[model samples]
Target: MVLQRLLLALINRAQLVERLAESKAIRRAAQLTAFAVIKGRLAGKQASARLRDSDTARMMREEARRMPQSAADAAQTVSRIRNTFMKEVKEGMREANRQIKDRK
Candidate 1:
């Protein structure tokens, strides 16, 4: 008996819904709601795209600034290594000279 009442109520509600659907005002409201949803989605997409573009630009700029500094650092490291090697060669030459003089 309870199930029968619920089914009857749903049938009545469905009939009322059909009648309401035929009204121009209801149709207009639905169209407006759809447009609002579409507009909101479009705005969100545009903002997300802009944020991605800005982030890419910032990253490119940072890379550009780092290039020269990294090159300079590499050059400085090479110069230090060369200086150390030359000093070692000179010290070895002096030790060799001392040994030769003592042998003579």
Candidate 2:
């Protein structure tokens, strides 16, 4: 009973804080910050994708493994390589963003 009452009090306090934060000034400031961060992220994804390492060692290994190494096979391998690379880069960027946000 005591614990339940304490939890309810904490929940009520949290709701009060949320309501206070919904004021016009706070909302506008949050909106502006959200827009700026989103713009930065879009730009970052583009720039990061462009600067991605085309010379990834795993790509080379997979290319070397392609036995007949026909043009079609090479193209497929390249596509696979790019997909893997992009997944890695995006994961890294996500971690970086998380760390940056946590720091702030």
Q: Which predicted model would earn the best TM-score?
A: 1
Model 2 compared with the native: what TM-score? 0.41
TM-score of 1: 0.44
TM-score of each: 0.44, 0.41
lDDT of 2 by residue, 1-104 (tens): 99999878876897776886989988999999999999999999986775564446556675787674588876887788788888878887998899899999
For residues 1-104, what per-residue lDDT tens digits would candidate 1 score against the true structure?
99999878876897778988889999999999999999999989986775565534454455456554577776765565566556656775897899899999
Cα RMSD to native, each candidate? Answer: 27.8, 10.4
lDDT of 2 at 56: 60
Model 2: lowest-lDDT 10 consecutive positions: 50-59
Off by over 4 Å in 1: 1-12, 55-57, 60-104
Kindly give the number of clashing pairs for every candidate. Answer: 0, 0
lDDT (0 to 1) per candidate: 0.73, 0.79
